[model samples]
Target: MFVEWMMGLAPGWVTAIPGLSRAAQLKALGNGVVSQQAAGAVRLLLERAHRT
Candidate 1:
């Protein structure tokens, strides 16, 4: 369905486009971003950014 269409189009790349508004799309983008950041292994960045 929608997931198949998206996965087919992007092939595992989740990007936050200008016109995409679906929760699943947003969640995909969010997860992609978080995964990328987490892959960097910079845990201190989260703490520093949120420790205001």
Candidate 2:
């Protein structure tokens, strides 16, 4: 569900979207997926964050 929402967002508007970074917003949208073992969606997001 969480992954679906994030994937639904426009790539160009991801960072522009409000309350979406630095306050663990992704972690929030991610629910427990952020902490689960082998959470691929969350891992990809963290990786993207690192690139920026």
Candidate 3:
């Protein structure tokens, strides 16, 4: 895919990895739910609750 190739990954690397899909890769590369994002969301919610 053009996105993967542009990101410096070899053309076949996406398919080479088991369970990896183009949609998943694109989501991850774009606005996906990463660990840091989840953690930050939880932290923010907890802080907001504490402030109430």
Number of the top candidate by lDDT?
3
**What tens-digit string does per-residue lDDT give for candidate 1 at 1-52?**
3453434444434434556567776576545444444556667776777898
Candidates' C-alpha lDDT: 0.53, 0.53, 0.67
Model 2: weakest 10-residue lDDT segment is 28-37
Residues 1-52 of candidate 3 have per-residue lDDT tens digits of 6765555556755545678777786775565344566788999999999999
Model 2 regions more than 4 Å off:
1-38
lDDT by residue (tens digit), candidate 2, 1-52: 3453545543433345676674555554455332344567778989999999
Q: Report the Cα lDDT for residue 50, model 3.
A: 100
Which model, 2 or 3, shows the larger lDDT? 3
Q: Who is ahead in TM-score, 1 or 2?
A: 2
Off by over 4 Å in 3: 1-32
Candidate 2 RMSD to the correct structure: 13.6
- TM per candidate comes to 0.25, 0.28, 0.41
At residue 10, give the lDDT of candidate 3. Answer: 62
